[model samples]
Target: MPYLFTCPHCQTRTEVEDEFSGQSGECVVCGRGITLPDFAPGASRPRNQAPGGSAGRRKRPAAWIAAAVVLLLIVGAGLIAIARVGGSAAQRVRQGRERMASIRNLEKIAAALNAYAADHGAYPAPAITDRRGKPLLSWRVLILPYLGEDELYDQFNLSAAWDSDKNQMQMYQTPAVFRHPNSQGWGSETAYHLVIGTGTLFPSTGPLGPKQVADGATKTLLVVEGRGASAWTEPIDIDAGATGGLINAASGVGLGGITDGGVCVVTVDGRGHFLSEATPSMTVNALITPRGGEPLPDDVLD
Candidate 1:
């Protein structure tokens, strides 16, 4: 059973359980402090009571209606909050998966490089050049067959420059291994690149054999993720002179942009590692050099 009550401050009506009769609580409608009437529902009115019974009944109905509206509002707001939080958590999970996929792509590329080295006694040159020494195709194109993309490799016109009309047509068929999982749009551009220079594995003049890498294979960086995307067949790559020593991706230092604030790198030994943005530039430079013989910090991999 419930008892009807009225908030004197705002004339707001409310219905309370019989147990709450004579107790005080704040009015749900007007937020005014109120004391419930000391009476139960359906009780006989006192002979001295002067109000119309119909008026009291109408007020009780109105109070219950207002409470229902407030409950709905609170429940709606709670549901919306849960939905927003769930959406954010799902987005984070997606980003994490993309990051791992990108890392796996680099690992596969590293394995291909090692396979190529085993057969040729040295890694592929950073780029293939014509008689005049102008670059024609990237090492990425050269390794297509090893990546199980033999059909794509056969479609390429290796004799022409990468941007040549015939070669350009193949851009639309970029391999999954060369494209970043989180790349903005579809294109033949690649996120992976070789850090070519005098002391690196891929020198300006030619590729270096494992024996030539005075630094241990595991200590030498063979390739890195670059900042800007390049055509998979393009001969361009990061020049150590132009990029300095920065290794973190998206730092505008020849590494691709990954939200994780780290860069994925493949060493000559076919191992992939993520280097933090906080890693010292000097330390990165030392790793890039195949034979600089610089001592690596014990925590370089940390």
Candidate 2:
């Protein structure tokens, strides 16, 4: 018959043969020295033994419980770290898709401008003014026919101001090319704008023909993506006089307002280009001019 015994050092229970009674040896589980009590075949219990030998078990030590808790905490922290990294990667992918959509919108607008230029000798003026010189409509309204929005354009009262009672209703009917995919807020406002000034393409004085761009059509900037949204018909755009430095997209200023650290622009040749925010202010100024006669370095376009 086998008798049960408990190891004092490790609290492990084991069965031993009756023949090993009264013998001294090392504990099987803990490797500690221990002695077995002598047993009589007919005796109900051992001479100096407790009522229940291994029937009732002892509770685990505090050390074991603490180790289990520590292991659980480590696993939880690892899971949280994985979740955060996954969320950041997903956000980056979403931003990249929006940037591509914005670029496509700029390309479409460039195509419309080119078509308009082909019919007319020069590009549209920054704004259309009445005989008294009061601003009425923006160049955005001038290219309506080329943009396949001739019906919407015909509804505008070109004689009255863009925000006039009749035209105000049409203000909410913004064209798809003017609104960026990532832009927020209400109204038919636009994120696309033109850099208008004395030497720029869309000058306040008058529109310039392709031949007038002495710097070459591909070198002159026609339109740019700006920060804030403006009513599509409003004569609002970037002022060359105000933009004296590089503007990053994160800053919501001049050049890089729509993309990360860069801005997408359409040149007079109907091609889109992404200009880094790190581009020198002088190089940007040269690109904006129609006939400044400044020599652009080969690396400036890179």
Candidate 3:
């Protein structure tokens, strides 16, 4: 079935097919990433969304900005080996290798997450808090030992806040695994962000175990490769409810993904995949929900 998709950036409309639903593609007019929409009958169409309310209707962000992503990328472990870069061929090759390395970084974090879950029976909450329930350190700090940074883990005063005098000094020593290769200019900061909010694997107040993810581990996104960098020790992450889009060039703060066309993501099963910025907002939402059990199309994750 084919339906019309409207680009929010350029306000241009085009007819597209359902096979591309939840995948990304570029707008012919302004050339921005656009996620395809599900034109199936009786499905929640974009019209039901709150007018000028992507924020008010978090669940239907795609509705507010219907048809705004671009083409799909390397789907699974194998990515499109080549991408065009403005610089010399060496730069392009270097970027390709760096993107691959960044995926490896995500895999390492996934391993650490598994190890932490294995030891504690659940993934660490977004942060570790004091007895009074005040946040003291981020999940990154809690997973230090799992990332083979045992010494760094031991030095932290778990009872103190992440920005405490003692902890602030140690922030510069963030493990290399926390940073992506292309995140060179960020300096000790990290680009990987965990998606947080209701229904997500990492809820605002939770320590969800593998058993809690009803969507199945392989279908759930564990970490998103963000384009912007933030302090590795800070507890900030993607707020799914607030961010309107995913894995695109026009994503606002906290919503942007890796450069080029694909957004690298790590699923709970410890596998890495490239999510196209054009992936339907609904499909992305379904994957973010831990136990929602939303039925996905065969091509959604394929």
Candidate 4:
């Protein structure tokens, strides 16, 4: 049965399930010690209980120690507060926050790209390569100045390959703006990427400007969010001909999105949108090409 439970310290009331009866833990609201009362729905409140509880509840930690579970509430920076009520609820809260965070990262990256284009007349080239046309540095390295990491950018040897001994340590200095909130222990890896191919905004031939996008700036795909093994400095991008904008493609390609059960994309107009897993392959492909002349699905924006 569900019954109203109140935290002794803060007097915050919640209608909780009977499964948590007799279980003790930190208060979900005020982060204080608490224990759930074991009772049925119609149980009468004792004399000093909530709604008319005594004033000394906050000062009485010893009264709760026998019942309060040994749990601590750690407030993560910029993350949503967790609920211990159920496993699925906690997971949902965590995933939603991660999706929002990844989208914000893409927005910052988009702003940097636009700033670069405003100054250079086009987005940075897909890669900085050697004289023999071997790829070295990613365009991510090219936009460091715009992302406010000028010192970290200067540390890189532009002429050397990303893995070259001269540029090795710089690979681990990925800026916070380029890193997804959930990426940990990956060591300077980034989930953000550019889609590159003949028909995409980043073509192997050259970087395309606003005037080159036939479908209009608001409709062109500029950057995508995906998990990859590549370091931020690696000159790797999703190949449109290879991946085709499908979320969580089957080939084990790194473009498998960062958010759980979701994909985030930033258009050439510097706006970010979250696409659900139910989004059709055709809808994703339509958004990938700037010159496809395909009309976007009406509900994609919804």
Q: How does each model score on TM-score?
A: 0.72, 0.74, 0.67, 0.70
The whole-model lDDT of each prediction reads 0.75, 0.75, 0.72, 0.74
Which lDDT tens digits does candidate 2 get at residues 1-302? 45565657777555554545566666544557766676455433335444334323443332332332344446657888999999999988997787778778877887887788778988787788999988888889999898899999999998989889989988989888888887776668787888987788877677787778899878888888887766889988888877875767345567656677678887877777778888888989999998999999765654
**Which ranges in model 4 have alpha carbons more than 4 Å from their true place?**
1-85
How do the residues 224-253 of candidate 3 rate in per-residue lDDT, one tens digit apiece? 877555688887788888765555656555
Cα lDDT tens digits, model 1, 116-220, are 888899889988889898899999988988899999889888889999988888877988999888887888878888888877888767788777888787888
Lowest lDDT sum, 10 consecutive residues, model 3, at 68-77
Residues 109-212 of candidate 4: C-alpha lDDT, one tens digit per residue:
99999999989898899899889999999999999999898999889899999999999888887788788888877487888899888777887788887667
- Model 2 whole-model lDDT (C-alpha atoms): 0.75
Deviating ranges (above 4 Å) for candidate 3: 1-91, 249-251
**What's the residue-level lDDT of 189 in candidate 1?**
78
- Give per-model CA RMSD: 8.4, 12.4, 23.6, 11.9
| TM-score of predicted structure 1 | 0.72
Cα distance off (Å), candidate 1, residue 285: 1.1
Candidate 1 Cα outliers beyond 4 Å, as residue runs? 1-85, 248-251
